[model samples]
Structures are given as structure tokens and as C-alpha cells.
Target: MRKSEYRISELLDRLARLNQSELWTNDLNPAQVAALKYLMAANRFSRAPSHVADYLGATRGTVSQSLKTLAKKGLIEQIRSAEDKRSVRYDVTKTGHSVVAIRTNLDEALAQLDQNESANIALLLSNVLHSTLAARGGRSFGICKSCKHHDKSANRPYCRLLIVELAEEETSLICHEHDSAA
Candidate 1:
């Protein structure tokens, strides 16, 4: 690989590690905190344990144990899916939401960057991530509204690929089946 490519890769990997370097003083482990944070930001369609495992690239047993611990700590609650009685969904409690709000040093450092620089960095990082995921045959977790499969022409915006109607709030959330509009 070229020098620039190597530098970019190194920078990204270091940034990711640094971002996750600090652990909160709370009772929850790093994995549990991560799961809660993901639940806090994830769309309704992506609230299942399976989806969490997929997003975190963790095994089912690991995710299941994390979910149980979170539920026991009152950080998250498991609810029966309205559509399917057998299906279960996870929701982050208010405490869970607050747990993830404990800002890290990484956030403070990123905040030092100007708006233009932040935007440019975000765009560049997103491009690199997309390219890498595509090359590795990994799933894209982009917002549904920004995906090529999103159909807004109908009365309700829906995913052409999943054949499911989307709620208004779901448009901005990350989708497991998301494909880049570009």
C-alpha cells in the first residue's frame, strides 16, 4: 500500500482505540456500556439482541449475557414485540441513556476541531469506512433515508429491500440493511 493509505489506516485505528480507551466508573462493563450506547442511538428496527451482536461483531452468547446484565441493572428493558409475540426488543432506560452521556476525553479533543475541519474529517472517514466495508463484504449501517433502497415516493417511506414501512423517526436512524445512495 501507499504511504498515504498506511497513514490513514494507522490514524483511523489509533483514533478508534483512543476513543474507547477510557472506561466509565460505573458498574457496567465496557461491553455493556457499548451495548447501551448502541441501543440508545439505534432505530427501532435495530433494537434486537441479534442486531446488537451484528453491530458489535460479538457472538450471540456474549450479547445475550450483556443484555441480561443490562436488564438486571435497570439500564435496559426487554419488551415483547408488538408485531410478533415471540419476538423481543430492547429499550434503553433513562439511566442507560445517562450512562452513555458520560463524555470522554476523546469528545473534548474532537470538540477542539473547527466545524469545517470536523465536517471534512467526517466525510473522509465515512468514505474510508464505506470503502473498507465494501471490500470486506461487511454490512453498511447508514441511515435508511440516505440508502439507495429507501423509497420516499409512497405515502410512507419504506425500504424496497426489506419491504417494510418506515416510521418518520426511523428515517434518520442507522439500518442493518442500509446501502449507500451513492
Candidate 2:
């Protein structure tokens, strides 16, 4: 039997189906959910439109529209940057924070729910994501590079998880599909 690779879309679909838990009780659409995810994953969602632009791989206009929609829904609040009032920063509101936290924790719990069969694989993937974030120089306080899980070895720079075999020249790049920790 040949091992198969999973597309991100497939994983997302699985997650979506299993996401029956009302972690985020708010009645948000897909775009809203994505906005919230971006905020939660970003720097406490305390940046301006430009910051969102980089994180979401979106343009300022798109982020602006989403921000506007979130703000109108009272799920988030926009505060003008004190240093640069012209710049607006978006943060979760009281309700927003609650739901965001719920979703975040529920996601963890769901992952933990599979503690029997393939839990190891689930756990390994989590580690890979953490290390990838670190390899990019993200910080725990900011991006992924600042994480404690990040590892930099002569064999795998900025990566602690031996997800895959490293190449001779770019020994740092690991096979994302392989879940072995070297």
C-alpha cells in the first residue's frame, strides 16, 4: 500500500465537520471565522491593517472590509494607535475574546480527544507547526520562531522535529509529510 498525502483543503474539511462543538458560539460565517483565526494566531490581534495584511496574505482593502464587518458586529473594536492615530488597531471585544478563547481551547481539546489510536501523529503535526513557526524567526510573543519547540541543528536548522529527512545542502528543510522526530 502506498502512503497518501493529505491536502490542506481536505484537512480543513475534516476539521470543519468535526467542529460541531460550539467553541465559538457566535454566529460567524466562514470569513468571520478566518478573521478571528488570524487575529488569535497573530500578535494578540493588536496590530493595524498592515499587520493583518501580512498575516492573512491579504490586501489592506480586504482586511479593512473584514475589520469593518467585525466592528459592526461588535465582535471586535478598533482603537486608534496612540503613537499614530491615523493607524487603527483591532482587538477582540469582551465577547470576541470569550469566543476566541473558547475556540482555541476547544481546538486543543478536540485534538486531545483522539488520545488512543493516531494521537501520536496528531501530536507530531502540532510539533511540526510549532517548529515551522520558529524557523521563520517568529517569537512566542509574536510569531512562531519565538516558540520553545523550535530546534536548530546542523542537520535541521530552526527545526527540532525530525518530520522528514534533510537534504545535503538544505538539510534544514524537512519532509512535512514525514512525522518522525530526528
Candidate 3:
């Protein structure tokens, strides 16, 4: 690998380890915290266990365990689908949002960056993530508004792929079926 690429990979690894270590606060482990955060940022259609697994790149069994722990801690609630009893949706609780509201060191560090620098870094990282996921045959799980299926020209935001109108708030949340407009 090129030296720059190697350094970037090393830096990402270090950042991930640091982030994981810091996630042990609020009586939650890293996995549970991650699951809760995903639930908080996910739209209604993408809040299921399967979607969580796909987003986290984790096995269904592992995601299930983390979800169970979150539920046990009263941080999240499971809502069974009325149309399909076998299907379940997860929602972050008020307590969960409160926990997520607590700022982390990473958030503070990012806040230190200038707006332009932060935006540039986000864009570059997003490109890297897209390439990596493509190479690995993984799902993008990107924001609904940035997806090719988003139809904002209509009176209401709509997802052409899902064939349903989306709420304004839902357009900003991540989706399991996201296909990047780029």
C-alpha cells in the first residue's frame, strides 16, 4: 500500500479504538451504544434488527444480543409490525435520546475543526466509505435525501424505490436501501 493510504488506515484504526474505549460510559457497552445511535438516526423503514446488522456489519446474533441489552436497560423499545407479526421495529426511547445527547470526546474534537475542514473531511471520508463498501459488497446505508431514489421535486419527498412518500424528517435519516445519487 502507498504510505499515505497506510497512514490513513492506521489513523482510522486508532480513532476507532479510542472511540470504542470512550463508549463505555452511561452503563452501556460500545455495541449497545452503537445500536442505540443507529436507531436514533434511522428512519422508520430502516429501524429493524436486520437493518441494524447490515449497518453495523455485524452478525444478526450479535445485533440481537445488543438490542436485547438496550431493551433491558430501557433505552429502546421493540414494536412488532401489525401487518407481519414476525417483523419487528426498534425505536430509541426518550432515555436513549438523552444518553445520545451526551457529547463524546470525538464530538468535541470534531467541533474543534473549522467548518470547511470538517465538511471536506466528511466528504472525503464518505467517498472512502462508499468505495470500501462497494469493494466489500456491503450496503451503503446513506441518508435518504442523498439517494438516487429520492424525489424531492414532488410536493412531498418520495422514495421512488419504495414507492412511498417520505416525511421531511425521514429524508435526513439513513436508509438501508440507499443508493447514492453520486
Candidate 4:
């Protein structure tokens, strides 16, 4: 097998070292990871629970389990959707935002590092991480909804994600890149 391809089982073994117990000691669990991962990808906006589950590579039961813990901690709250009466979307609380926002500094650093990092190292890291995510059909979901270029027009907003017109009320997620309204 190519060096880029580590057998699937071996991949998790290497990644497991990066996992920490502190999160669970404080009441977090794998389920919360799924929900949080979903919210992280969803931006600050809310999304249907089913979408969260699908993206997390988890079952509805698992997403529901984690959402309960997150809701109890006030890290996430559910809101009814105008588009679908039976559908509910979850929004991360400010505290939850803080938890995810901590990575902003890291992103900024990476943005800076990209200026000089050799192509070889970047490629290697990307390959390793991408391999793992691709195995599960997961994606980092990086884009400009988190960027300063995004704007809110009235209740709706326009975004770079698609050329079509949009609204703040329409956006399901906003990343760190979006600037607060001036």
C-alpha cells in the first residue's frame, strides 16, 4: 500500500492519541462531539437535527443523546423552522460559540503560516487528515460564511457560498469570518 494510504484500522489508532479524556470528565461525550461537529459545520446558525446526524456519521439516537447534554448545558437551543413545521434547528449558545471560537486563533495562525510553509509538509498533513475524513465521507466545510466578506441585508443576507441573493434570517450558519454589523 502507498504511504499515503494507511490501512483504515491503523488510521484511528494514530488519531486516538489526539483524543482527550478531559472533555468527558467534565460531562462531555462522543455524542456531544457529533452535535458540536455539526454545529461547527453549520456555522452559528441552526440546522435540522437530521442533517447534523448525517454529517457526523452518527445515528439519530446518537445525535439526540448528545443534543440533550448540550441543551442541558445551555450550549445549544432548538428553534422552530418557518419552512418546515415538524423540523427544528439547533443554534449554539454564546457559550457554545466560545467553545468553538477558540479555534479562531489557530485559523489565523494557519492563514499566516500558509505564506511560507513548504508545499511538501502541507500536502502531507492534508493527505493524512483528508484520508481519515474521506474514509467517513466527512469534509472540513471551510468557506467564507466565516469570513469578513459576508454581509446581512435586512433579515436575509447574500453570501459567497452561492450567487443567489440571501438574508441573515436565511443563513443556517455563520463562521468566524463574518464581521459583526457596523
Best by lDDT: 3
Error of 1 at 74 (Å): 0.9
Every model: Cα RMSD to truth? 2.4, 11.2, 1.2, 7.6
State the number of backbone clashes in model 1: 0
- The digit string of per-residue lDDT tens for model 2 on 1-182 reads 22333566477567666674443357665556667656655542235666665555567788788788888988888888676778777777877666666545446756666566467766676676567656874332333333333445444534344343333333322222223332
Position 164, candidate 4: lDDT: 49
- The lDDT of each candidate is 0.85, 0.56, 0.93, 0.60
Q: Tens-digit lDDT track for model 3 on 97-149?
A: 99988777888999999999999999999999989989999999989998999
> Which model, 3 or 4, shows the larger lDDT?
3
Assess candidate 2 and give its lDDT: 0.56
Please list the residue runs of candidate 4 whose C-alpha ends up more than 4 Å from where it truly belongs after superposition.
Answer: 7-12, 20-22, 43-46, 101-164, 167-182
TM-score of each: 0.84, 0.51, 0.95, 0.57
Model 4, residue 52: what's the lDDT?
72
Which regions of candidate 3 deviate over 4 angstroms?
Answer: none
Error of 3 at 32 (Å): 0.7
Candidate 4 similarity to native, TM-score: 0.57
* Deviation of model 1 at 141, angstroms: 1.1
Looking at candidate 4, what is the lDDT of residue 161?
42
